[model samples]
Target: MARTYHVYIMSNRHRTVLYIGVTGNLAHRVHAHQDGTGSAFTRRYNVTDLIYAEPYADVDEALRREKQLKRWTRAKKLGLIRRQNPTLQTIQGPYG
Candidate 1:
C-alpha cells in the first residue's frame, strides 16, 4: 500500500492565528488539535479549525510543503487558504 501524507492549516475561531503541519493521518491529527492535545501553539491559540489541506503521496513532499507554508507570510498563507476556501469555513470530514 502507498503511504499518503497531508499538509494542513488550522486556524483559531477569530481566524487570526494559523498553524501549519504535516501528518500521515489527517483526521486523527486534526481531532487531536480539536481536543487541545495537538501542540502547545495550537492549544494556546485555540487553532482547531481546518482551513486548508494538500495531499501528497510522498511524506517528504508533505514535509517540504509544510515548511514552505510555515515560511510564508500570514497574508500569503491566508491567500492560499482563501483560494480554496473563500469563506474560510471549517472543513469537517476525513479530508477537507
Candidate 2:
C-alpha cells in the first residue's frame, strides 16, 4: 500500500535553523536527515531533529502543507514546533 504523510519541520537543539519537508515514509525521511543525506540545507544547518509533524491521508494535502510551511513566517514556524516539541528532542535515528 502506498503511504502518504504530511509536511514536517525539523530543527537543531537550539532551534536556530528550520528544515521543511514532506515524505511518504516519515521514519525513512527522518533517518535521512539524521544521516545528513536528506538535503543540503538540513545537512549544512545540522537540522537532524524532528520537531513537528502532521500526518495527512492524501499526497495533495501533504504537498499543500509543505508549501504552506515554506511560506510561514519564522515566528509561526517556531510556534508550530514548540507546540509539539517544547523540549526539542532529537528524533531517534532510523535504527534507534
lDDT for position 10 in model 2: 86
Give the alpha carbon lDDT tens digit for every residue of 35-96 in model 1.
99999999999999998999899898888899999999999998999999999999989673
Q: Write down the TM-score for model 2.
A: 0.85
Error of 1 at 67 (Å): 0.7
Per-model TM-score versus the true fold: 0.96, 0.85
In model 2, the worst 10-residue window by lDDT is 87-96
Clashing pairs in 1: none
Off by over 4 Å in 1: none
True lDDT of residue 2, candidate 2? 58
What Cα-based lDDT does every candidate model obtain? 0.92, 0.81
Pick by TM-score: which candidate is best? 1
Estimate, for each residue in 45-68, the C-alpha lDDT of model 2 and write its tens digit.
888888778888899988988998
